[model samples]
Target: MAAYVIAYDVGTTGIKTCLIEVSGTIKLIASATEHYELHVLENGGVEQDPEDWWHAMSVTTKRVLERSGLPASSIQGISFCAQMQGLVLVDRHGVPVRRAMSYMDHRARLELKEGIANGIQIAGANVFKLLKSLAITGAVASSVKDPVWKYKWVERNEPAIFSKVYKWLDVKEYLICQCTGEFVMTQDSAFAALLYDTRKGKECFSESVCTMYGVDMTHLPRIVRSTDMVGRLTANAAAYLHLQEGTPVFGGGGDVSLIGVGAGAVEPGSTHIYSGTSGWVSTVVSRQLVDASAMIAAIVGANAGTYNYFAELETAGKCLEWVKDHLALDEINIYLEKKHVSEAYESPYESLYDYMMDAIKNVPAGSNGVIFTPWLHGNRSPFEDANARGMFFNIGLDTGKTEMIHAVLEGICYHLRWHLEAQEKKVNTSRVIRFVGGGALAPLTCQILSDILGREVETVENPHNVGAVGAAIVAAVGLGWLGKVDDAKQLIQASARYMPNMANKAVHDRNFKVFKALYKNNKKDFLLLNAGR
Candidate 1:
């Protein structure tokens, strides 16, 4: 017997809903994507309306069901893999008080400074506060983008809304609340807040740390496991999504926790790199660890008793998206003008990227001495600097569009390599890493990543939907269609493998040194230029 589950991947820019069929193996049936807006305020605030997320989910769910030609009753469960560390405050009725603050929102600098950056410091955090956090939760809320500061920012600035807050939820929790009319946060999502104690047998919100941060413990919600059934669909949500009123809703995790599951990196020490709009290098580990200097931490995973040593790059494929809009304007206009040509492609960006890949295929490994910094939206791992910006360094008279475009791809790979090596300093990373996400669809990217990282890069089938597939796996496990989440490793097989080419090692090595030096040399300038903006 086959069971159907719809997994919604709620991301930074949009919502992707996938209908997956589980029988002997997991298979994707139909999928639909609907984009929403990310409002970027001048004050460094990034937000999206919770209504926009609901709208996209509704539209995409109907579209997926329609395309699959399946009745709503066929779906046994619903799950989600969403962007983490976002702050979604809702009232007692489960309605958002204001626009949801994005994970990228770092407007809480003042709150961050006042809360954790004031006294004697260790790695930019107050030493006393850092020690207390480490003792209690094994991690600290060290970044401005952390949800606690955002919570404080709301408490200090928008007290009226803060007064009405019932619970603080992440992006998926908000969606889950809408689906089931229940207020709960998954264990992995709770850990992301840096307030959850992940120690064995003590997996609950840390009262000491929460108190230290001045957060009202009551604002936190009850914690549930990724595979636990939160609740059934409510009548209102069912009507909006055109589904059954009581479909079981499973507690799927965030992208960082579950994408590796879909990548088949389930065992400890298995690593996977995700290159989406934002990119990250995550490794499954048995114990929690933190490298305060590198801004890397082993976050709780969706699977029980596991953690993901995670490092992130804010803009990965987004760099290419920028290139398409800004650099390839003429090509984009041409593609749009040719209506039939555009319709022939699946994704709107696919044709443009094909043109780009073809254009830069001949460019050499190092982009002819040109190196690009992929900090278009600032960087997080290996160093935390909100003021950093992206630029192309060492462009000469001989430089061409091909070299520049190729450099962007190389720069992204370089940053990923930096993250991989940083993780290696504390934990042993996989020699042959699994690469997943829309970016892995490109053979050129896989090869470049391999050449840059000096490791074998393998990609799985339907790399773009790994997040949704992970969510589906969670649903399958919860529904008893599968025994456990690790069963996905047997179901998922590698589609392609790219081995490192040692011939290009010398050039990449030279360029990488300069790449690291670029930030060290110009960080002061970056702060000077971008501060107070």
Candidate 2:
């Protein structure tokens, strides 16, 4: 028997609601998306209203259910795949005390310096504090964007909001509370706070870490497994979503953990790369590991007794978005002028990228000696520098916009290669990588990524919705429709495979060396120009 379920992929900028039918295989029935505001504060803070998340969820859920013609009673379960490391402090009634802080928020620089950057240091973090954090949590709050620093920032600056804080939650946890009225955090979410002890058989909040960071332990919520039935939908939430009141809600996980399941990278040593607004390279492992020097660690996995050696790039596809807005503004205007109004059914934002790809595909492998860094919002893995900014280097007088755009894509792949190499140094990464997220929609990107890494890259059907698919898999496993999360490998199949073009290896290698050196050569300048920016 097939079971119906809904998975809400709540991302940084929008919500994608997917309706799926689960049995021997997962079938996506229908889906819808709704965008929301991401308020970028002048103080380097990024936030979004919790009400916007709830509104987008309600709107997209109704749209998907309507498109599928499935009654509310037919849906068996609901779950979420959301952005991680966000801070959503809510009151006793589950209402947010202020706008939810995004994972991109880095306004806690002073707090981070005071809390972790002070005293004797290693890799720009206090040696004693780093050792204690790694011994307990297998991770450290070394970045200014880390959630603990944001928590401390609120406590110091917004004393009134902090006073009413009942429990701290991430983006999906807040939505879970909205749906079920339960104050809970999934295991991955808890570990992301860097205050959770990930030691085997002792996965919970660490009192010593909390005290060391001056974080109030009471602000943490009850931690739950990703597949556990957290609660049932409340009447108000059900009415708002046009669903049944008692629909079971499972504890879904952060995108970093669940997207790999959707990509069928479930076994230990399996690896996947996700490129969306943000990007990461994740490899499944049996035990926790940390490479403090590289700023990479094995984060708690969605499944028990599993961990993911995760390396991240804070902004990947975002660099492409920057090009679309700034470099290709004229192309967009021309594209809009040439298209008929009826053809507007297709999104101009997407079609414009397709048009840009048509232009970039002809621009040779090395972008004509140009190299761009995909650090528009700074970098995380392999280096932790909030002051780092994106730049186009080695652009000769003959270079054109097409070559620069091609370099942006190559730059993203180059950074992924950096992360892949870092992960390989510590543990064995997959020879062939599963690539997911919106970036995989482009065959050119797939081919370029394959060429840059000198490995095969595979993408599954509806690659953009892998996060939602992973959430649906979690729901299926929870409903007994699937044996376990790893069983997802039997259901999802790769739609396309991109093989590396060894012919272009030399050019890419030359560019890659320059790409890596750009940061090191300009680190001092980046600090001087972007400090406090």
Candidate 3:
């Protein structure tokens, strides 16, 4: 018999809870997820109600516990890995002050530019400040999506909320506080705070940086290690989840860090690719690195004294949703749903995914020469450009919906390959990379990605559940169930492996050339066009 750890993967759109065995080889006993709303404004605003996240966490926690049929006391620890770069301002009593400003929010674009570099300086940071930030934090971003600018946006636009906020917390920190009744942050979350003096032996709020930036360091939470047992579960949290009053609540790293663990990328030189709503390529490195131009950073990993080279694009699986919504696949959808009606679930997204995958199964590569730019929300890695837009270049009179769909899929992989190539500059990117995320369930997508990157892409069972697995493993380590984080690799078992189809190599190679040239040719036009809006 094996004991377990309960963990949560609080993501951008929802919360996932898992009851996982904490023995030598970690394994998921049961898992559940609850989704919430993503409110997007036409003016580039994206927000989510904080209460929804708490509700999801509570609901899923109970569901997972019930489904696992394991006594709550058997669960030795609890932890979380959640979305980063989002602000969740809370009052002294752990209540949210306002809707969280998501990483996709662009309402602070002007504020970020004005405060940082107005896009004229290196990587959008003021030239002098850039050097200092790079030296201290090893990272800097002038994007509106950055939490620093989001904080300034609130202070400038919503002064009342700022006045009442007791502390600014990330999603995981807020979740932990809600469960443990202790307001604290993990080291990985603190590093995301641009004001932190990360280069120091003790990572803390930098007084000099705060003074220069006019940020109140008092608003930041105290930092704690991921393996630290912050506090026992509070009575309120315990009652809501039907768990014991004194369940150990441990601190775990953020979602990406935990995902690295879930993907078995804990060792330095291991690379992993993740593609969900957003896509990123991360490689664990021995030291800190910064490529301001590419918006790449070697930030803290899940463990102490380790770093991960990270870069990402704004869109990946999102493009599929865009296609599903915009295309008139009525005939195909009806046919596929009828074909697989017995296999269909209540989730419309799942049904639609099946329809789209079945419809595009035979579509040849290169999308029949239609190249799509998956910069629907702008580019983030390999280059930073808000003005960038998605396009289906080389569309011909014969272009059909299926070819266009394939192009969209191919486009996302191409952009990821671009990010991967850029990441290769700083890290020894492995020829075989571990791929994990919700999108990994799609064999076609994985095959396309492998073909594009010329790398063997492998996915473990329940790719989307990897984040929860990572969180649970972190908790297990904190509980003495595991000796070290890397040892948790015993939990991982590869479900699928994708290899490049050499016969279509020429087609992808030619299209890749066109893909690289598309952005450069439209860079000026992208800015000029976006400026008007």
Q: Residues 368-462, candidate 2, lDDT per residue (tens digit)?
A: 89999999887888999988999999878898888899999999999999999999999999998999998999999999999999999999999
Of 1 and 3, the candidate ahead on TM-score is 1
lDDT score for residue 97 of model 1: 98
TM of each candidate vs. truth: 0.97, 0.97, 0.94
Give me the runs in candidate 2 sitting further than 4 Å from their true place.
332-350
Q: Candidate 3's residue-wise lDDT over 162-265, tens digit each?
A: 89999989888887888887889888887787776777575877777766566888888888888889889889898887788899998888877889998887
Q: Candidate 1 on 162-226: residue-level lDDT in tens? A: 99999999999999999988999998899899999877788899998888899899989999999
RMSD of each: 1.9, 1.9, 2.7
Backbone clashes under 3 angstroms, per model: 0, 0, 0
Residue pairs with backbone overlap in model 1:
none
Question: How far off is residue 501 in model 1, in Å?
Answer: 1.2
lDDT of 2: 0.91
Clashing pairs in 3: none
Candidate 3 residue 228 C-alpha distance from true site, Å: 1.4
Model 2 error, position 408 (Å): 0.6
